[model samples]
Target: MSSSVPHAKPGGRAAAGAARAASPSIIVIGVGMKMRGDGGFGAAVIEALRAYPAVVDRVRLAACDGEPARMIDLWQGYRCALVLDAVRGGSERHGFVYRRELDPEVGDFGAQPGGTSHAVGLGAAARLAHVMDRLPGRLILYAVHGRDFRLGAPLSGPVAQAVPELAARIGREVLGALAAAAAGAGKPAKGG
Candidate 1:
């Protein structure tokens, strides 16, 4: 429900690049499964971002089912990548959100649960990308705790409520990256 969504969405590659260089350099990727309960957090957040006017205009957006290769490919050229996904296998309460900026050490990810919906999880994706040198300059992950993953079930109550909240936070991060790119900030992506 933010009133500050940007009015214009940047067009395809050529147009987006010519019109705004930063738009292509920054990518936002949402990963999840819609058919399972609470597995749709990533997609839901992306949907909220799409409806918001400010976000789509300033960056590249992608939705994926947490497939490792596809995930790496989508973020290739971008300098900064903000990835959103559902997480399970942890003690965290449902609807809890964890924000972690992974380090370059591809070996140890500290057990990042990228949800049970995928065969290989997101931490594996990052490691693979690192091995192939496909990682963007900065890769930040926002993981939402999932309560259920039964196929065809709807999102849990807490997860349903968390969708918009996480979306707004991500929207702000996108705009901040846009601003930094615009002002020639040229700052390192410690937390971009």
Candidate 2:
């Protein structure tokens, strides 16, 4: 789990079918800086996800460029929100992926403001949303640890290799969430 991608299942077809089977109510928010080396993890995930046309059609995907305000608006009225971002200086090594829930009760999964300079707005915006009572019911963050954040840089080798697997994980999680929601509402899960 530390060295390789977890949940190594192919999600392209399943995700596409799931998207086509129901209304799109899940939002995946990808936030990153495009030119800042591995800091562009969110954008990479979004780019990778775009390959599934059906999923793209049914799910709301936003490459927020680290703007938490935009993320707030993009996820409004959505059933679930999945956020991706890059962070540095964490216990996780470069290219490490961290997935955690942001329940309304627990606040922010122990995430502090300014975890990464680029992610400052994200933490703050989450607090603002809490204050304004605008948070989605289900919020999760899939954050990747970044090595280089210099301008005009590309993702390092490890980070680049991890993007596809991470994207697949995002798809699976989104589909699962949609399925659970459908089940809770007494409807069959789409594409299950």
Report RMSD (Å) for each prediction in the order shown.
6.5, 10.1
Q: Which lDDT values do the candidates have, in the order given? A: 0.77, 0.73
Error of 1 at 51 (Å): 2.0
Clashing pairs in 1: 5-53, 5-54, 6-53, 6-54
lDDT of 2 at 112: 37
Can you give the TM-score per candidate against the true fold?
A: 0.80, 0.78
Q: For residues 9-125, could you state the per-residue lDDT of candidate 1 as single tens digits?
A: 657566644544444677778788778788888888888888778787767777887888878877776788888888776888878888888687753356564454568867888
* Model 2 weakest 10-residue run by lDDT: 1-10
